[model samples]
Target chain A: MTSYSLILRTAARFLLPLLLMFSIFLLLRGHDLPGGGFIAGLVASCAFVVYLFAFDVAPVRRMLRLDPRSMVGVGLLLAALSGVPAVFFGEAFFTGLWLELELPRIGEIKLSTPLVFDIGVYLVVLGSVMAIVMALAEGEE
Target chain B: MSLMWSTEGAGLLEWVIIAAFALMCLSLGLATLRLLLGPTLADRVVALELMASITVGIIAVYTISSGVSDFLDVAVVLALTAFLAAVGFARYLEKRGHGDD
Candidate 1:
């Protein structure tokens, strides 16, 4: 009643790696591609889906060592704060702005604050699902 | 905004639509299957939560695809309301589940 069978636990264990990899792929391609942070987050939350299935919510929560909603709050704050750079540049809020640093060895790599915001969104979504599902799963136990 | 405006009407835009539609269908189909077949109340809750997140992803893609960030408004609404729905469903289930016992 408290934990999943061995087969399910194994499946859950393998699920996170696959999901995390896919989430990163989606996030990296977000700007020009259809994939993005929110989708990536949902994809990543598949790890939690497996965990909730593999173990009881309380045990999994203890292992996680973080409250999912609080994690979501941190994500939202980071995302919102990522917009601050726009204000510094006198651009509107949530402006898509970036910086390019050309290193002699590393080549021209472009980085954006928007990307950070997207990352925040990704975390927010994953955390949200984790929190909500944990509550429901707890009830089940 | 600049990205979308600059990339407007190219083959890439069409490709974006096709890929998004493909993923949307795939995820939604899976979610629907779980919704229909999920044996336990907790299973249904988890699946529905996934569906909500999927819906948000679709909306975000649509927001950029349609070249109107207005869809973000819809995304926000979905995010806010979806959580409320989860809470309500849990409470309702708690009551009904105990009643069954």
Candidate 2:
């Protein structure tokens, strides 16, 4: 693949972080909202895909020090572990669990096991999707 | 098509959705035509990309009309994979001597 114009590179540099942050936000709110881990991970991976298009795969690989396959493994582990917590609690597997915490200046924040599961899903999706992207971007370039 | 009229709120939102669906259909038809008739591999790839985007739009319209937000996740996934497929195919073409011209 050929390098894109300077304008695209510059724009992508500015856009990548925003896209990543948005994906995380999506993941955080996914249980109650339209967003989720799978979609968030896909969205985050697209940021890298755009970066790969404008620049190349080398920088992206360097940025992502961990291998994509490892990311998938870690994600699956997190998701599985999320379910295991319920098993230890003697609840049925994959049960929806929540925790309420009060923080200074921000009032109460609710956290849950499903969000952990979503994060795992997010990582899995990101890793798998980026694996495909890395294969394509690195091939014959 | 019938559901578009049958769903409640048959006012401006319904007409807007109908118009959006009509536009999506037209674009899908054009993309399919290009996919079939394009002389070059790049042209077909581009047509395929356009069709993917159109399909995403259709998914969004369906989500809106049905009042089910779950389908939006499907649309998001579609949009994400669509970009990946385009890049992969473009690379394949490059390896086949297209040279990314």
Candidate 3:
């Protein structure tokens, strides 16, 4: 077994949630800002990587609950599906469709197909990177 | 060089930013030298980390100079990557039995 450091483990535990939150924030603000799915996914995967370094591959895999390959598949499907609604509307493929909703608490909210696509990209990146990282880490043992 | 000394529109903040940029560039050059010349793997890793941090700082300074807050996200991601890289290197060193602790 690889030797672990208590300081590293403790830091990882504290950093995991913060990193995940920041990644989500990046995803949410990505539409108009510099943040985006690719960077967000990278950050999220880095969080998992930190955990992997502190512990082992088994626990990291277990914590993920779903296989990374499946995540990639799901992301691709979502990205493809996001463009389908445009076809139904008699528009060109991958045309951006937007919806505005009014809510009492949060006021008006704007949603778009591009946002969905971004989420898909986020998932694909996160999954692929994790898959590679986990495979390499497991191989080391 | 002209922008650094020109007094037409340059303010105190701009001067400070220019100074920061110069210092960051100097540090970056020094870190690169260490990364290339360090005798040990640990020293090289530390130099790499320093370079990464300087990169983040450069991004932040650019964002401020450009008046675009979006680049801060880049800084954030760069910082995260640097931290992960450091952790990964430490783990690698530990596995190779070079860990000091």
The top-ranked prediction according to DockQ is 3
Instruction: Flag clash pairs in model 2.
Output: none
Off by over 4 Å in 3: B1-10, B99-101
State the DockQ of every prediction. 0.06, 0.40, 0.78
Which is the better candidate, 2 or 3, if ranked by TM-score? 3
- Model 1 TM-score, all chains together: 0.57
In the predicted model 1, the residue pairs found to clash are: none
Report the C-alpha lDDT of model 2 over B1-101, residue by residue, as the tens digit: 45656668757787798899998999899999999998888999999999999999999899888878778867866776786688667656755875333
Ranked candidates (lDDT, high to low):
3, 2, 1
lDDT per residue for candidate 1 within A17-135, as digits (tens), equals: 76678678878778876678888887667656666666667666776677888889989999999988898899998898878999999899878987999899998998999988887
State the weakest 10-residue window (summed lDDT) of model 3 chain A: A30-39
**Model 2 Cα lDDT, one tens digit per residue, A1-141:** 464658768867976897898788888878777888987997899888878877888899888898999999999999998887788778999997889999999999998889889989998999998899789666655
Model 2 chain A poorest 10 in a row by lDDT = A1-10
Q: Model 3 fnat?
A: 1.00
Q: How far does residue B7 in candidate 1 sit from its true spot (Å)?
A: 30
* Candidate 3 per-residue C-alpha lDDT over A1-141 given as tens digits, one digit per residue, 9 for 90 to 100: 876889989999999999999999989888877778898999999999999998889899999998999999999999989999999999999999999999999999999999999999999999999999999998888
